[model samples]
Target: SKLWGACRNPWDTDRTPGGSSGGSGAAVAAGIVPMAGANDGGGSIRIPAAYNGLFGLKPSRGRISSGPSVGEAWTGASIDHVVTRTVRDSAAMLDVLAGPAVGDPFTIAPPAAPYAKLMQRAPRSLKIGVFTSSPYETEVARECVDAVEETARTLENLGHRVEYARPEFDGMALARCYLGLYFGEVSTLMDRAKTEFGARDDDFELDTRLIGMLGRTMPLPDYVRRRQQWNDFARALGAFFEGYDMYLCPTAGQLPAKIGELDTPSHLQMAARLMLLLKAGKLVHRSGQVDQMAMESLARTPFTQLANLTGTPAMSVPLAWTAAGLPVGVQFGAPHGDEGTLLQLAAQLEEANPWFGRYELLEAMI
Candidate 1:
């Protein structure tokens, strides 16, 4: 609970800045920096972008290399990039940073030209599928839905085709599959901690330790089964994309949560207690509890995980604000290796409905 004293949203000081790239979001939004580095294994990049009103993109899996330091993270669900105030900044950095480092396991051919130049050119008339409802069985905020609808209208005015549509997929199953890998990683981290410091239960956060405990209970075969399921989802989503240039949806299911609203200390205490239950060989009864808990959290931020599963490029464009004056973003996902499409769209959106002044307002407040 005391990690960073809760990174507060500058837009609405009581709200979260979003994480684990939350520091990047807060710094960029407060005008402390033009941009800041971030990475996403799940919605880490986009969630903060939505919460802080910045442009955040999680590039295709192989587009940027992780090598010489670490071959990959979360089995390639993660990738590194920056969160920026403007489309051009992200584009410029991508041009400078994207490419294979030595001993990289995968490499995608660099863009034909620099991303900054690509941002200048108009994107071709594109067909986009738009959905306000989360594919997951979760409730989406009305403002979030409105933000997406408004962005779709804006795209239509720009001569792009926008139609109400969504791909067919089981959000729950995908979430469960993802959790297996996610939990396993947490468990592995605890192992490292033990090696480095002879860490104990109190060495980690209560919720984190609970997650690690759950991860340990998961068998290696179950983790492998989950990883293999990625291909099944990839094929299904790939087919859905064949009919459209991009998919548009809310970046998050709800507006930003007030600071301390999502504070998990009490919940973590419960989790630590749950660990005791499991150790007493109460496996059958409590195993489902953590999975359900995870699902409840994932339901709120559902849309971004699909791109991570399929290794497609996705970006969150800060498009609108709530009645309470908090920012809300609309997300767009493009085919693998088609980040140009997302950047081109972001530039168009930036030109049509500029967000340059939100930072200035934040600056004034600061």
Candidate 2:
């Protein structure tokens, strides 16, 4: 926007609303819509929610099918749902969209009760593991850290136990695996675009063309190997969940960046342009620069990818706003097929710390 190229955050015009769903986030946050559809592969939904202060949920794999036209997306890592101002809207929408279509691959166990009904009741007091720092070991903003810390304290006061812990996984390896998916997916999509839509090489953006080149050149074994490592992360997260009812962390490692803060720097852009010109995608991968670039790009959003790779239901709740009047969210993840619990707790949190007032004020100002 500058809320659809309205590129303005209604809360503050200079800051980003966030992306790949930033438009919807901006629209809804500005009260243009009560809710809007969104999806997450590598944190598309939650990232926007964190930056724009909405309630975003990424349901478990197979919770909602990708059916009729396609089976799934991004190796079944992406999930479709809605971002809303209230917990109830999300739960209600899930009720409408939460079943499998005929000829679908598989389905999650249906909620014990309707999620809309299930969420009205408060969850039992339970243990939650909280982590405030970036999983990729990036520098986390103090405000983001404070958001999680305050949430832990609040959870403690609400009769839940909170511990400073996280699922044990090689964060760097996960980043690499995610980037592997990126390369492969982009390559596939670009191929489709070129063949079906009669697109030219220069039709796409430079960064996109470069990534697709890497995907086209990537060896089969390498892609398969990356998918294989996903199970290790899932197992580790499952182990963590066995001891804890849920995991809590920063939805993002940093507060909303001012516009253009995440753009590729001039030096890197120069190098990438040359690589694009030479068509040296594999050379970039072999140089270990992929890891460096992936880490640098992912550092701001290192937290949300774990849940996607692990196929768990996760959410970003609008619980904290910074001193500068910017919103930053805290994330909560639940084990597979356990979105009911997540919704229940979200309902309770909604009551304990009502955020509806903030949105009302925002709507008034807008």
Report the Cα lDDT for candidate 1. 0.85
Which lDDT tens digits does candidate 1 get at residues 1-366? 576477788898888888889999989998899999999888889999999999999999978887768888788888889999999999999998789888888788788888999989999999999988877678999999999999988999999999988878877778877777788889898999899989987777766776777788776787788899999888887887899899999999988888877756676677567665656223722457655775677877888888888888999999999877799988999888999889999999999999998788878878
Q: Which pairs of residues clash in candidate 2, taking residues 3 or more apart in a chain or in different chains?
A: 1-4, 1-5, 1-6, 1-7, 2-5, 2-6, 2-7, 2-8
Look at candidate 1 and give me any clashing residue pairs. Answer: 14-259
Total clashing pairs in model 2: 8
> Which has the greatest TM-score?
2
Give candidate 1's error at residue 131 in angstroms. 1.1
Model 1: runs farther than 4 Å from truth?
Answer: 265-268, 277-287
What lDDT would each prediction earn against the true structure?
0.85, 0.88
TM value for model 1: 0.96
TM-score of 2: 0.97
User: Candidate 1: deviation at residue 190, Å?
Assistant: 1.7
Give one digit per residue, the lDDT tens place, for model 2 in 233-263: 9999999988999999999987777877766
